[model samples]
Target: MPGITSPPLPAPDLIDIHCHQLSGSDHRQILSRDVHELASHPIAALDRIEALLTNRRYLSLGMHPWFIKHQTIETAFLRLKSCTHHPKILAIGECGLDKCIDTPMSVQIEVFSRQVQLSEELGKPLIIHCVRAFAELLQLKKSLAPTQPWIMHGFTGKPALAAQLIQHDCYISFGKALLQTGSQATLALQAIPLEQLFLETDAAGVSIDTIYAAAAKIRGIDPINLRRQIHSNFINVFFND
Candidate 1:
């Protein structure tokens, strides 16, 4: 209801594919919201989302695996479903398998699977959050064969893993890790095809422009070119539908 009547913002030069906090400036972004956070206080969370949509902010909504408690799943998922029809809700994620979390792998898989179905049904991209569960994630992708894009956000994996996910048609998004010397993200960014790549700040508390500059330096290209390529990637994935 909010974004439906509001005018869309101009195309952004720099796109932050996934982040928790919204920047004050008019940078393009997919602001992520975990449904777990909405379970206990649904009205408050939905109100916040409405305010964001009213302001013409794009959103990605999903249930993060780490916070998947059995009691809250129904409530959280219903809230997630309610928000998906909003035009400004661009993706269905920041969700997926995380092997290190205390939540059982079985539970994580089930919750993530539901979100996967929702994404496919709505024809929206999925922004994933994976940790030490590449094998399981890949297998699920293979089995499901979703038509929508799945972006691996905040990636810190090695080049081999990055290539494997790209091969599986997943876009890789680099974050603050790219700023570190000799980091896996920095190295992998150099190898990833520009079309299959994206950049984000996630919850790193850094400017997206800073990440773009660091990534451009690593890939031996001008920051303007990197920004342009990522803007193209963002349109292909987020607006293709």
Candidate 2:
């Protein structure tokens, strides 16, 4: 043991609220990191749950509006409901309105509503994936008056939209888009409070570490402080323990 010493332990990092690398090619790499991530995928793919659990990471399940044609509403609802009680599945979604998609709005609404209801009934937060349908999403939120938290993932909307979401007590997550110079996401990130903010990589190639650093710069705060706040937010909204 002469002239030898063990390496110090690593510290924990920010929580990636939404990502798709759970069971994908990069799953092992993500697991080896110090950060935590909420793995998102279709409810139909419950078989992938095991991989997410292996690292004790977070999970968000939903029937994305873009892939509605793949299954009947009944089947999707059933699959989602089956996983609602899983201990590691902290949230329900990646589900929300998407105006640009070819799927009929009515059908999308129906599936989205059921998922929202499931989130409400199970007392879990939602990881939304809204796209050009903020109005409809807000309307649904108004109609439901849910108490559980709802986080909009991959938000690159205007600052006003970010303000509106915060006013409604909905959190907004900034992803790789925030790193783009002069982007709307950058503006919104500046306007959003540290409490209502989250950083994610989504399915993008960017790392959470980079996203957190960029977010910290946009808000003009220390990266460590930003990481601490988001980690607190994650526990406050998801763990509640």
Give lDDT for model 1: 0.85
Residue-level lDDT of model 2, residues 61-112, one tens digit each, is 6777767776666765665676668777778877888999899888888888
How do the residues 181-225 of candidate 1 rate in per-residue lDDT, one tens digit apiece? Answer: 999888888888999999899999999889988988899996777
Least well predicted 10-residue stretch by lDDT in candidate 1 = 3-12
Model 2 residue runs over 4 Å out of place are 1-12, 23-48
Worst 10 residues of 2 by lDDT: 28-37
The segments of candidate 1 whose C-alpha lies over 4 angstroms from its true place after superposition are 1-12, 40-44, 53-56
- Alpha-carbon RMSD, each predicted model: 7.3, 6.6
